[model samples]
Target chain A: MHELSLMEAVRDQALAAAHADGAIRITVISLRVGELAGVELEALRFAFPVAMAGTIAAGAELRIESEAAECHCTACDAPFPAPDGCCDCPRCGAISRQLLRGRDLRLLSLEVV
Target chain B: MCRDCACGEPAPDPAAVPASAPRELTLHTALLQRNDAGAAALRQRFAAAGVRAVNLLSSPGSGKTALLEALAQRLDPTRLAVIVGDLATDNDARRLQAAGVPAVQITTGQACHLEASMVAEGVHRLNHQGISLEQLELLVIENVGNLVCPGAYDLGESLRLVLLSTTEGEDKPLKYAPIFHGADLVLISKIDLAEAVGFDRAAAHAAIARVAPHAQVLEVSARSGAGLDALIEALGLALPAVR
Candidate 1:
């Protein structure tokens, strides 16, 4: 799965940050996955151990925060939450063509010691 | 006089002086930062070489190769080249070469998507095959046959085209909105079989518009060569003057 490679990216970044900070080890990795990022949390979890084995982030707690998908309605110029991948505007009866957020997959913070 | 082994340094505040305490470092960065950087570099290279690259994305059996074959046949093969990605096999590359164009095949093994690094490698292979990027006008990267993972990876293409076949159902766009949302052009492929497959054109158009209103949609059939000219024109591929 692509999630495995994503986890490897996370591991590489986290270890680098920890090393730069002169930290001995990483304890927790916090990530913010957007709803429309095309990433499955379960898949990320399944890939976590495989990607982190024998690394400084081994056995580290993985914390994920989800960002809700938002779309900008082209007709009404309003932003609304896109639940279930439906970008239909709640303010007006218009399908939103602009996506405001929700495609982000960010590594927010790292807990190191 | 200092307290707690502080040599006159205002007695190190106890509230903030925790020994061996874990530190939380904020690093707000995209997960695909490396890939994004790589893609950006590729874009600059393509611009420098004066080559327009287009990335094709679709599920398996979506006729991506067939559409490319038709386009290759129409365009000047000397100025056009293609890079095909598959889990295993050079079948697509062989097909495009047989159709009269320079082609490179990338066997990704188990990867479902083609990353920027892979595209760079494929470009190297294309060079080894006596095809130079500066001599090409259009370079197409046919991504692996998956609608999901490829959406997240940008291979430094000038345009992104996604194909949806008539047999795939009208709701396919809505079901896979992420990939469709990122498309610059959406091709409704296999139109010659639409009637045979009972494909609802109206519903498909509606679904595509609902999800990808910003994308220009075109109906095409590689088998009959219908709308291939429009597809070529939309991609800004100019035919040879003599042809």
Candidate 2:
């Protein structure tokens, strides 16, 4: 899975930030992973420690804030959460709903010593 | 010392101390920020070099190699060279080479998709093999044969070309809309076998248009050399002129 690479990136960023702040170790890494981001949380967790080896983030906790898939209904001009495998707007029952969010992957914060 | 030890003197046990003591370090960093930065650098490099890198995505046996061979035949050899990605084997590269252009293969061991880093590495490898991007008109990165994973990763390409063969059902685009949505062009390969395979070209085009309205659709057959000129013309228009 690409989660190894993603975790490597996370570890690199965390290490760089920790080094810049003169921190001895990283405590936690917080990330916002969207539903449609195509990242598997379990896979990410499985790969994190391996990727973090020898880095500041080694043995650090990974905190992921998962976001639900959301869409904007073109017919009703309303925003709603989309169910898995179905993008029909919950309000107007229209299938032509435009995706608004839930495809994001962002590193929000890191807790370090 | 025995008395102190027996009395349980307040001394930190060297064995009790963790080999690597856990420390309180707080760092705020986005997990993907590093890759994004690398990709941004690659984009700048491509732009500066006036190189338009196009990533080709498709399923296995979808004729990606054949299409590249056809493209090499049609394209000016002095201007084009291809970099192919595969899990193993240099078959695609060999085929492209047979067509008279330099080709390099990046064997991504067990990696389902080619990321920007792999592509950057591949670029270096190609350069070491005497294929310089400066003299190239187009750098076609034929991504590892898959539909789902490759759609999620951007290889610092200027454009993404998704190839769907006519033998596959028209509903493929609708089913794999993520790949279709990410594509700049949707090329329907194997048009020669359309009627034999009961492929409805119009319906297929319509499905693609539904998912990606902005993507240009091209129907081509590498076997018969039909509809390849249009693809070449499109490539000429999309790729920046190499000096």
Which candidate number would show the highest DockQ if scored against the true structure? 1
lDDT per residue for candidate 2 within B1-243, as digits (tens), equals: 235567566666756754454454444354556556767788888788787788899998999989988777666776777779899999988888888978889899999888778888878987898877888878888999887677777677888899999888787887766567667888999989999999988889777865554578999999998888788777764332452
Q: How well is candidate 1 docked (DockQ)?
A: 0.58
Fnat per model, in the order given?
0.73, 0.35
- The positional error of residue B102 in candidate 2, measured at the CA in angstroms, is 1.2
User: Residue B22's C-alpha lDDT in candidate 2?
Assistant: 46
Q: What lDDT is reached at residue B92 by model 1?
A: 95
lDDT of 1 by residue, B81-142 (tens): 99999999899999999999899999999999999999999899999999999999999999
Candidate 1 Cα errors over 4 Å, as ranges: B1-19, B239-243
Candidate 2 DockQ score? 0.33
Which pairs clash (backbone N, Cα, C closer than 3 Å) in model 1?
none
Tens digits of lDDT, candidate 1, A15-110: 999889988778899999988788889999999889989987899999999998888887786789987566778888688877888889999999
CAPRI tier for the interface of model 2: acceptable
Q: Score the docking of each candidate (DockQ).
A: 0.58, 0.33
